[model samples]
Target: MAATARSTTPEDITSPVRELVIPDPSSSVRWHEHDWPHPLARWHYHPEVEVHLIRESSGTVMAGDWAGPFGPGHLSLMGSFLPHNWISHRDDSAVVRNRDAVLQFDQERFFAAAGTLPELEALRPLLEAAARGIEFTGRTAVQGAAAMEAVNGTFGLRRLATVAELLAVLAESPESERRYLDSRGGTYRLDASEAEVFNRALGYITEHLEGRMLVPEVAEAVGLSRDAFSRLFAKATGVGFNRTVTRMRLTEACRLLRGTDLPVSDICYRVGFTNLSNFNRHFRATTGTTPSRYRRIDQL
Candidate 1:
């Protein structure tokens, strides 16, 4: 595979907005079954809303500011331009064949349909909620998994029904788990100039994901003083600089536990944690499950 474009600078390289050209231009819907080492594996977003399911394996799911562990049966809806990615840690290759079942559709087309269909009127609230990114849970998630799978193999109107049913199931999600991922970032997109600074910072952080990262280092890399950069980044991304790095590292740690047979200690160090207890604590706080339990449950 070729690179993420060495022609661009680290800041330019880090812009997560993906310009998507759907496989079927005539159809509003597009389906993609990607293997890891997949060309689109990095953190990126598109204007089209995405319905995503992890068909096989387990890993970290990053949708906007929300970072969490996900296994098979994991289902999520991402609004237009919401930055997200899934990283699976299977081996040296970090490979998982047929890992995702994804369908992306135009938001404009969806609203156009909703305007004429009363049944789709309920879709308005659900679609609006998608702006901040949403995850389906409980019965909704189980049904969503089945619905997306049904969508994977069908065509014509049957395919349309599966997608509709999937959305309907998610629309009925229980209030507790059908919550938004975050309040900031989904609709409040940065302008081009502001994004350039952040894009560079993102590239710098991910490049050093396995090492101790300093705020000053990133500030210098992006050509700003520490204080100014700190304030700007917090304002721009709605999270502290250090927190972003930790989230990135821990997210990768979740992938390691689920996709590989590595021991907890080794996985901890590999993901930039020098201490086992700290890794365990952070894992529990972020994922609601220990590393061992996370791996075991996913396998079962």
Candidate 2:
């Protein structure tokens, strides 16, 4: 029998459809909250598996050949390489600053941890099921959100505990109404060479944040063309190629502004900006405040 078409509108996605991975620090698991109009707000994919919670708004999720409606407390777990996106119809598309709480982790590492600890051993089934993508509802949605929030406020070893606790809660719930989102079978994985090339490019970006940071230079270093590099970078980092460089520069500037006595103008050039006004404008757009105010606020 033919499958019924998924219900979705045209506004739910973007074109030239590229995939991406979430840029993560070298950690076992990571949690963060981002509202829409943010960098991760795009149609993309990453290697690490993801657990997503919709904290606000009503929307539709386009998950690889499937589309469905969602609202606050909507929860889902997607395996590696499964392309997905969420589009909201709230306020005629105004921005929501804290619309989602997300937890992402390396599947290999998480299962490795699960293998070592008997407590986590039970997660094997759920983890395997997640490879096809799982959506949680009913009681599981509430519990999962609570668990994600716990990790959000925590740091150090305790955060891992919260994540584990979350897994247990999710795994035990019979009424979670867990459903697979990917109508297609399992997803794809980056090959060894792709992983290496992606990592190398990431390293290059990190090390060369100061000056003359161009996408083509990094692409040439990684043996990819400009267009290929741009698409792959957007897929891996969920941002444009040039915007990634700008972000790296301004991030360094933000750190210097808060942690050091360096004058803002001097720090601008240090982080690759040629002019002060441009620096101020980018900083405000990224951090929601000017450099001078950020410095003073951090000092207080």
Candidate 3:
């Protein structure tokens, strides 16, 4: 439970990332759980700014236009309106699980706390720029992870100090190392038609994940050309069509591994992969561990 911050079942929030209330907003420091039975790779946005410290999981962490394989000690700060998701392979025990500690607060609350402080004010731009998403690597991520972990049990001024230190570390992160997820004004609105297209494509992909999925086939299902669908899919979801489909398949693979008693080869075929080698390769690359090892760890 210390991994995820929420107390409710994962079904409560349809979104991949759910909001967890920090008790005493003023002193809210807690871990939330995000063990959804279903895998999520959809594109959605939130109003709160989020800072995530990913521990012991590996996957494609997508935010706006940025996407990358996340490893242990990975950290990211995403501003409001940035759509993102983490897609990981499942453990062999049939449980698709990963733990992340998220700290979220409103922009207004952040500015109000720093309005009078010139030093803090200087970091506002960085925060604003992160409206898309900012991934930290190397020393900054490691240092930030330590600083954030310090806030886990802190209270009163001490907790606030940890939060400030975390933000300061984020502010000082190298701009070159920080990748943005979306370009300015590139956010897409999901209307009925777009939603229909997305849902249809997603449904079809999920249903046939064990087989080859062609862009043109998906496009035809939604009445769009391959090129048009690809562009729209990326624009609307902040990820490409192939990547989205791969993420979906991988997500399901994780679910079966943790929730079912099926063999790894069976799971690979069930998730639409024709070859076990490719599945294993992708699983290891995405989760940073073999399916069997992941299952073993989760079981313990």
Candidate 4:
């Protein structure tokens, strides 16, 4: 049977479109709230660092090659040029007001200020990590969202202070409360063809994460020789192809463990691991806890 064609209209969201974000003349950062279905609500990338807060709605949030669920209080930071978007599941005529709160500032300006202010320099590592995008969860998300609201309600120095507070919350988040959103660092420039190839690779990884995945086959499928594909994949994603696959499988396993009642052993094989011991070991190494214990803590 032939697959049904997916139709798209002008309102359809597509990713990585270059966007021009202009801050207000009097403000150093752009802080604004906008409704869903607005012109700016699309998959786009800009040169400014972004702090984003979801005020309402549930949807899939995409950053680079990562896509996952998001809802109210979803807070994240993306460094310059990271492609991102949130697609809310809603009716065609739905209109959601104040669905997103966004703050964008020039990275070079911030870095220049940091060069003079020693205190601001302390956040260097957090800004660096934002190159791959960062998602906050648990208490970090709560605090970050509150800070964003404060930013919304203030102006001048107070707004900037609240922005700093939000960044501090993200920078100090425990590893268990944050997730890096992309394997690909956003610094690498990919032309349209390269971006398409990389997106296809990511799509394949998403679809096959629950099964055995091999590099050679994936390379051939993407129409590159194994060695060439290895170089491009590593350059574009900052990780080896096999390691990326392993990470994705482990991430999926974590989701299942948190959101479903599946037995740990069952989730092990279900996420493409051939052995339960190996699964447990990798999960522990990556997440700093055994799968069963991770679930227990999540439940608590």
Candidate 5:
């Protein structure tokens, strides 16, 4: 259920990308299953707490700043606004059916209800720890995954009970049987109204990774003035726009360096860094090593 870290990118507390999840108005929880290439399978965070189980496929999972491999039975709980994505390695034409089971609920409301139902209080700490993202192991993983699946087949009180059961299983997991993914830090602060704007801006950045990305250009693309975009971007991402772009480029550079035989200079430009010296400097600062050293160590 656990895999080794695939990238040396130091764990950051938050990411700028956000996913707006709208739960059914009738129910407190949203449970569903989807395929590998579904529209929801991307790097984004939401305000709801999520219990996610991977039913199939092997891929690199990026939760916050933690990147690692995951396969079937991979279960994790990510708290509000913690960016996460499962990047499955498959042929472009391949399709994996029902590859993910996900349950998302408003933990704040659950906590409020716990005041009247004292029995629910025991789960408070587990929900708090989930802000850093928790990966269950051994028996916890097995039972949590089962309980998550059970939520899909029930309705009304039965479905709520199943969700509680899943939380209890995860809450009871020993420290040794669970791994916290993100480092201690702040999470993305985004308003629901601005989610679409940020999503469009982030997508544009991803598409143009091979070229220079300007604040005014991206602002125009997202229908915001340059100054307005700058302020909002800093508030939502906890950093300046340029820094975010640099970090993203460095991430892509690391991938190319580790997985391909591309030259370091070529990688610098490919990831939108016009200066090799600047790329090398930033890589060393973020990863604590030079590009050649990182590739050599990772390859071995």
Candidate 6:
């Protein structure tokens, strides 16, 4: 499937599509609250570089081609325009919250601070490569998570020190330990028109994932023909309409399997899978493990 088109509106185009805006990037690192009552399944991006630490939640993490299950101890660095989201599958009553410490500064600020500083200048390539996405798997996450937490709480000079420390730690870490996502390409940004359409479609899909989600329905919602919408959606999201919907449903199913005590059949129906056999097949295909096995592993 092709990816969705870029946004074209001024507000949607100029500003990042985030729920909370962090206006100050020069002072202290900004912390945002992402505690939605229900699971979030929307595909969105921002202009800032994101450092996320998964504390006590599990979900499907989508970042370009890197789509899979992620649980506690997972940390990632997402550059501007790289779309991502954590779709929680836990029951609505269960608290599925994410603790994020984000720093949003442009290339200009980075260069202005580090260009003349010999120590920081050496890490420029690592920062540039992070424009794609970076996932830390081992000790880097442990160290980075602490730094993120400290920066979130500190202020003034201490906060700046923490932020600098976080970047330096991430930059100096061995490349072999950092898992890069979508490193082979340049960064991508959406125009106003495309961003609006894509966000609307994504919102609709998240709300109606438990029901029949047809291509025509999505196209009509976006004021396009089925064929035209299909091409555009594929182009924008890098996945076809059917595939995207299926992935969304499977993501929800994984959440339920890990965070809820619901039975397999119940989970299938809850996530919009009417056919039990088909659900089993697709779930295994997408996750590379059966629902029962996934649940067991997560429990362990």
lDDT of each: 0.73, 0.68, 0.65, 0.76, 0.78, 0.67
Between prediction 1 and prediction 6, the one with superior lDDT is 1
Candidate 2, superposed: residue stretches over 4 Å from native: 1-26, 188-300
Candidate 3, superposed: residue stretches over 4 Å from native: 1-24, 28-43, 92-98, 184-211, 219-235, 238-300
Clashes of each: 1, 5, 23, 0, 0, 22
Tens-place lDDT per residue, model 4, 1-300, is 221111122454323456679778877888889998776776567888899999886655767766566778899998888877776656556777999999888878777898788788868888888988999999999998988788876778887888789778888889898889887675655665665565567656655656788888888878888898888777655656877678767766766776678889988987799999999998998878999999999899
- In lDDT terms, how accurate is model 1? 0.73
The full ranking of all candidates by lDDT, starting with the best, is 5, 4, 1, 2, 6, 3
| Candidate 1 stretches greater than 4 Å from native | 1-16, 23-26, 188-210, 218-236, 252-300
How well does candidate 6 score on lDDT at residue 22?
Answer: 55
TM-score of each: 0.74, 0.55, 0.62, 0.67, 0.65, 0.73
With a 3 Å backbone cut-off (N, CA, C), the pairs that clash in candidate 5 are none
Whichever of 1 and 3 has more TM-score, that candidate is 1
Worst 10 residues of 5 by lDDT: 4-13
- Pitting candidate 1 against candidate 5, the one with the higher TM-score is 1
Question: Which of the two candidates, 2 or 5, achieves a greater lDDT against the reference?
Answer: 5
State the lDDT of candidate 2 residue by residue for 210-253, as single tens digits: 66788789999889999998877665444457765676567566
Per-residue lDDT of 120 in model 6: 63
Which residue pairs of candidate 1 clash?
11-200
Weakest lDDT window of 10 consecutive positions for candidate 4: 1-10
What lDDT score goes with residue 173 in model 6?
Answer: 81
Sort all candidates by TM-score, best to worst. Answer: 1, 6, 4, 5, 3, 2
lDDT for predicted candidate 6 compared with the true structure? 0.67
lDDT of candidate 6 at residue 193, scale 0 to 100: 68
